[model samples]
Target: MLITIENRNYGSFKYKNSTAYVHYRNSVVAEVPIEGELVPARGKINMTTSVDLKAETMISNPNFMADVTSGSLNMTSTASLHGKVSLLKIFKFPATAFSMCNISFFILTKSIDSKCTSKIKL
Candidate 1:
């Protein structure tokens, strides 16, 4: 299921990008793209965010579906954050992002693979 562990701004920060992926039995079942572009926030910055990733659409994997239906499925959701939130601008300190989670694609940076094994519209 799609779970948002963190929603409150905690204060404004920025990421090059982020995405969500559904995996079953070590296979990538689908991708949920997080939309945004790089924008410099003003002296003081804030961002409102929510993922469009849907839990209902996570039925593309038959085995997963069967397990889930049978109440024998073992599933977990994880999140990784890699940005500074010490200040509203978050960029006050000089640092580089070392990691993030569920980023399945990218358009600007060549750092991520811009393709997914499969996709289902949500």
Candidate 2:
């Protein structure tokens, strides 16, 4: 599945070294690591990435497949800010940041049969 995350924060704060996860019944099915600045003040950053699912893992957990097919899979993310200061390009300040954010959302799948029709009849 293709996962896209957009940061809509309108502040000086930025998200760095971020990671997103796909969860099924509280277990992580996939993990995607993201690096770079995400969304600026009054601006937007769209990051598109993907994760691969193991067939063995899915087969072992029948409920995971059921949730995916039913479009009930959930996604979550956690990230911290890049807090570093430099002065005159000669001196650097230590980062003293201890903050993070967690966000969650659900993935929904739509049936194509409701939108399009098959021309070839079997």
Candidate 3:
């Protein structure tokens, strides 16, 4: 694995209406939740970015770093997934010039429960 992720950027979730995003390896994954009455409304999970792969040549290929150009991995959440806690696990594999990776986990935030009903992995 031995992969390093820098330029870490993140945002907080709103009480009811909010968005959360995680960006890694030039790609972004997000889970959004709808806002309700805080205690009486229904919450839903929406996908703004589904762990889509975006090549950051600088990281994917060392040659791109030789130019000394600056680049960024940006992720924006459309809505907030408000629960008690959230978790992310990454698995990496060596594949030629590029690395193959996958993410898996369960997030239990405020509205989220331990029943393992709502889950997202990419």
Looking at model 2, residue 1 earns an lDDT score of: 37
Q: What would the per-residue lDDT of candidate 1 be over residues 1-122, giving only the tens digit for each residue?
A: 33223323333334444555445445544454543333233333334455443444445555755665554433322323334333554334422222224433222343433221221111
Order the candidates by TM-score, highest first. Answer: 2, 1, 3
| Candidate 3 local lDDT, residue 24 | 41
Model 2: runs farther than 4 Å from truth?
1-9, 62-122
**Tens-place lDDT digits, model 2, residues 7-100:** 3333323335755554444566666666655343445556666667444654577686776666654433333335433434455443322322
Task: Assess the local accuracy of residue 6 in candidate 3 as a C-alpha lDDT between 0 and 100.
Answer: 18
**Which is better, 2 or 3, measured by lDDT?**
2
Model 3 weakest 10-residue run by lDDT: 1-10
lDDT of 3 at 74: 24
Per-residue CA lDDT of model 3 for 1-122, tens digit only, reads 11121111121112334433334433454332334222211232332323333445325654445322333222222222333211222332221111123332222221311111122122
Q: Pick the candidate with the highest lDDT.
A: 2
TM-score preference between candidates 1 and 3, better one: 1
Per-candidate clashes come to 0, 0, 12
Model 1 ranges with Cα > 4 A deviation: 1-10, 37-69, 77-122
Please provide TM-scores, in order, for all candidate models, with all chains considered together: 0.37, 0.48, 0.21
